[model samples]
Target chain A: MKLLRIYRALLTAQLQATAQYRAQAFLYVLFSVIRPIVFLAAWVAVANARGGSVGSFDVADFAGYFIALTLVSHLCMSWFAWEFEQDVAQGNLSPRLLRPLHPIHYAAAANISYKIVTSIGLLPILLLVAVSFHARFQTTLEHLLLFIPSMILAAVLSFLFDWVQASTAFWITRSSQVSFVLGRVSFIFGGQIAPLALLPGVLGTIAYALPFGYMLAVPADILRGGVDPARGLLLVGAQALWVLLFYAALQRVWRAGVREYSAVGA
Target chain B: MNAPVFVRDLAKSYRVHEREEGLGAAMRALVKRRYRDVRAVDGITFEIGEGEVVGFLGPNGAGKTTTLKMLAGLLYPTSGEATVLGHTPWLRESRFLTQITLLMGNRSQLVWDIPAADSFRVLQQIYEIGESDYRVRLDELSDLLDLGPLLHKPVRQLSLGERMKVEFAASLVHAPRVIFLDEPTIGLDVTAQTRIRRFVADYNRRTGATILLTSHYMDDVVALCRRVLVIHHGKLLYDGGLADLATRMAPYKLVVVTLADGASPRFDEFGEVVASEEGRTTVRVPRESAAERTAAIIRAFEQQVVDLSVEDPPIEEVIDRVFSGERPLSQVRS
Candidate 1:
């Protein structure tokens, strides 16, 4: 209960601060939509060139997949690797450590709040793309019901995984190269740039078994009308499993990293 | 009865990597690393009762800040046992964390881009304070610190003193029982320092909050703390009342004599001459022998002496002498 209230307050503050800079806020949200839209257009052109289908996905299907991918990507993204580096360099992290609450909670809240605001801006663009491309998605009550839960679980897994990665700041002075490599790997395997089913044979098999696909493609698949009862249940289970695994990793890294932090000032 | 903050043989040491200064050395360090042990807080022990304001005093690199970090639960001690309000600080349980606040002078925990009051709201949630309680505490703090106008200003827009005032209010909005302040008044102007000092004193008096403060400014120590613990080179030097420290380290009074004419006078028989001008002489006289020395000086210049006065040595001088470890009380008396 306390954590919830703290998150709400932090979210409110972040939104208000973002609102204060109207032009910058608008540009940020617009840029967020533009990136996925460009990706969607490029993939749609590819599907058209292939006579409107690629691995069982037509142009409409590509539209729905990319729209959902954008939303899921926004939910799962983590900037703390960069944020923590700056904080460590400027000695800002020291004050956070002195506070009562774990600093990760604040970071998580800020990330979620920014996503919520950005999603609001994304709604119109997503609707426009869906209507123009005639995207065919299963809008049944059952699919909607499962979609909500899947999105939530996907967010949890993403946050936990990003937190474990950010905790590396305590051990290394610079983790940007490591984070960059991890992000690139996730991009290829997580199905952010392409659907997992369309990947070459071996890569497709690897993506199905890894955590990255569960973070991006699973939720997108659910939104694109690909989740039957069995598959929906299986996707939810995978998300929960990843959440637990990543949470354990977060704990392990936090415990050992703090022990080595030295709390030294720059 | 107030609870005791107990620390048993606290020690904190770090293994810092060492590298020579050169491109070749840097390249070599990339392949082979060497480290040296730095004992930041070495085997020091002290205790404070609830509501007691204790000052941690030391020169730069004396481990004052490091010890405070341990007490505040920010850093794990290399080896030792410490408990704040009956709970090991490093465990940092939520219940314990909710009841404590730590403030650093150079750091502001409040959100930089927003008004300080907004930061208070976030802290309120973190502490789970009821709306009524939050408002009451905010009002009280605003009235005490005169934070009404400053509360709405972005923290970055405020001056150092103004920002510190807001920072102080933000830390206390939860009404923490134990406050750890590290140089809270550092880098502030004299008037601002006095204001902050008074606020701290009043806060302690009203709420009976236990305060452990570390500062390099002796005036801060003298103004807010009755008891001070001095450390140097990571070792505890003295832990006692301010007056006791002064008396223990310095046993002499400074005497200044004024003469009527612009002529140098011989007064070596009275005491050691610290300074002499055309018409005045300043001397350091043993505390016990102040009266005798004054009388002898008066007799020597019965017609020439215009005015004379005596006062205790400044605390800064006494501190310097204590840290040097050479100015013994007996030596000063003799």
Candidate 2:
């Protein structure tokens, strides 16, 4: 209970910090919203140009998928790689380690808070994109109910995956290059750039099994009415499995990483 | 009775990769790395009692901070055992953590770009302090540290000293029973250093909080700690009262004599003359022989003496002597 309270406090403090730099925060949200909107437009052009449908997705279906994709991607994005680099360079990680709460909680809380504040602008932008594309969305009570759990699980899985990547800071002095490569891979394989079904057969199969797809693609697929109810349940199960697996990996990396931290310089 | 902050033969050594000059060496290091053991904290044992403010004194890289890190549970000792407050430090149980706080000078735990009051509120949540208790302690710290005006300003806008005062306040909101202060007054001006010193003294007096402080400044040790544990090359050298350290390491007093006329006095018979200037002479005499030397110097200057005084050597000189291994306390006393 105390740990939970501390997480709340850390989250609140991060939100206030983000608020203090309103111009930067505003620009960040704008950039985040613009990137997805552009992708939505490109996919719309492709679907329309290709005779109004690609595979099972029409232009409306593309719109729905991209809109949900934007939301999930925004909520799940983890900046821990950059954050860890700065903290290590500046010796700020020392104080965090001194705290009773696991340092991951601090990272997780800040990420969650930033996502919540950024999502305010994001939701409306997503709605605007959906309206422009005349997307067909499922607003059934059941789907809406499932969306909550799915999004939550997606966020956790994303955070854990990024955390394991960030923990590479222990062995490698510069993990930014690694992070960049992982990010590019995630963009292609996690269905951020396009729906998994749109990819070639072998790549699509690989994407479905990898942890990357469970982070954003699975959640987005559930929301876009791309999957039937049975498959939706299966996707949820896949997300849960990845969450557990990634969480375990996260713990292992954290334990080893702290031992490897040199706590160098001043 | 409280359990000792025990450590039985604790050690921490790092296998640092050795890199030589030249591109070839760098490339070779990437594949078949050469490693050297940097024993930061060698096997040592000591225990600190509850509520004892012990100063951990050492020059840079003397393993003071390394040991403190181990005790704070930030690092795992390579070998041996260390239990703080009856709990293994590296395990970092929340109960043990709630009773301790670590403050590194010029390093902030408070949120940047926000008012310090907001950071305090965040700490309130982090430590799970009741609202009433938080407010009470906030008001008390504000009054004590003169934090009223600084509370509402963004942390970046505050001066270094102002920021440190707020940092100290933030660390104390939980009223921790044990505090580890690593150069807590570092990078601060004299006025700010004095203010923090006073604050630390008052806090310890009021709450009886155990403090382990590290600083390069000897003045800080003199002003705040009656007992200090000195470490050199990762080895414990001396652990006792500050005055005892000075007395043990330095057994000589300096005597300066000024002649009434513009003439240098010959005091070689009295002691070893260290310096001589116009109408003045300085000499070092054994502490045991100081009184006798002073009388002899007085007799010699009876017709021409203007002024004379005797004092112990500066603490820094004594510390230098100790570091140089010139005067181990045992040898000095013998």
Candidate 3:
């Protein structure tokens, strides 16, 4: 209960603080939409030129996939890898270590709060695009019911993975490289560049095996009604397992990092 | 009860990599890095009782801040045991952390973009300060530190002094029982330094918080700390009353003699003439012979002497002598 209250206060403070940089926040959200829209436009053009069907996707299907992809990508995101690297390098982590609360609470609160605020700017733009494209979204009661938990699990999984990456700052100076590589790898394998269905032969198999798929592609697939019941349940199970694995990894990394911090005198 | 802050042979060492400033050396370091053990805090032990404010004095790289960090639970001691409020510091239990705060002048914990009061609110939740107590405590600290107008302004918008005042208030929002201040007044003007020193003294008096402070400014220690721990090269050289240390290390008194107007009497015969300005001569006399020297000067120039007074030299000179190795640790021990 105490931790909960602290997170709430942290979140409230973050939102108010972030609200001050209105132009920066709006521009960031505005730019985030550009990539997904560009992908949507290209795929739509392909479908139209090829008589409204590219593989298993029609023009409406392309619109729904990219639009859902945009929302899911924004919802499941973490920046603390590079943020923690700076904090470690600049010795800003000292004051935080002295506080009663674990520093993760601050980072987590800031992440959740920033996403909440940015989404306000992002969702409206997404809705406008959805309306303009006349996107036909497959909405089933089962998918709707499963989508909420899957998205939430995806977020938790993403946060944990990012923290694991960030914790490397304690051991290595160039820890940001880890997050950079993670971002590129996830874009390729996590269903960001193209849906797992569109990936060539063995690549699709590789995506299903990695945690990145659970982070992005799984939620998008479930929401778009692309996966069958058995596969969807399997994907959800994979996400839970990844979350647990990362949680364990996070604990181990944090312990080792703190030990290193003590030896080096942060 | 145990001392509010206690340590026994507490020590900290860092293994730092040494690299030459060249591309070739950097490449060689990548394959096999050479490490050297730098002993930051080398077996220094002392206890600070409740409400006691002790100045931690040292020059650059003298391990003052390193010791403070260990006591604050921010850094683990490589060897020996340390406890703040009876709990092992490095364990960092929430209960333990709630009772301590480490404030660094160069680093601030306050959220930079928000008003300081909002940051205070966040601390309140972290420390689980009750709403009623939080209100009362915030009001009290704000009043004490003169943070009324500064509390609402964004931290980035406030002046250095204003931000420091807010820093003080924010650290005390939880009413920590033990406070570790690392150069809390660094980079502030003289007036701001004085205000902060006074605020520290007042806060200690009111709440009886055991404060361990490190500052480059001697005025801060002289004004607020009656007791001090002086360290040199990572070793505790002296730990006692400030005046006692000064008297032991600098065994001399400065005698200021004022002659009659236009009376240009030679003072070198009496003692070491430290300064001669406007018919007044300042003499440095051995502590044992201060009174005798004064009487001899009075007798020799009874008619010429207008006024005379003897006092111990300033604390800064004594500390400098200690750091410069003029006053060896053996002298203090003796």
State, as a TM-score between 0 and 1, how close model 3 is to the true structure.
0.96
Deviation of model 1 at B20, angstroms: 0.4
lDDT for B306 in candidate 2 is 88
lDDT tens string, model 2, A1-266?
77777777777778888766667767887887777778878887887898888888888888888888888888888889877876775567887787666888878877877877777777887788788889888656666666778889999888888888888877777876788998899888999888998898799999987888888888888777677767788888888998999888888988888877766543
The second chain of candidate 1 has a TM-score of: 0.92
Per-residue C-alpha lDDT of model 2 across residues B52-98, encoded as one tens digit per residue: 77888877888888888888887788998888878888787888788
Which stretches in model 1 have alpha-carbon errors above 4 Å? B1-3, B286-291, B324-334
lDDT tens digits by residue: candidate 3, B63-122: 998898888887778898988998998888888989999888988779989888788889
Model 1, B105-193: lDDT tens per residue? Answer: 98878877888878888988878889999988999999889988898888889999999999899888889899999999989999999
Predicted chain B of candidate 2, TM-score versus the true chain B: 0.92
Q: What is the TM-score of chain A alone in each candidate?
A: 0.93, 0.95, 0.95
How close is every model to the real structure, measured as TM-score? 0.93, 0.93, 0.96
The top-ranked prediction according to DockQ is: 3
RMSD in order of candidates: 2.8, 2.5, 1.9
Candidate 2 chain B: 10-residue stretch with minimal lDDT = B325-334
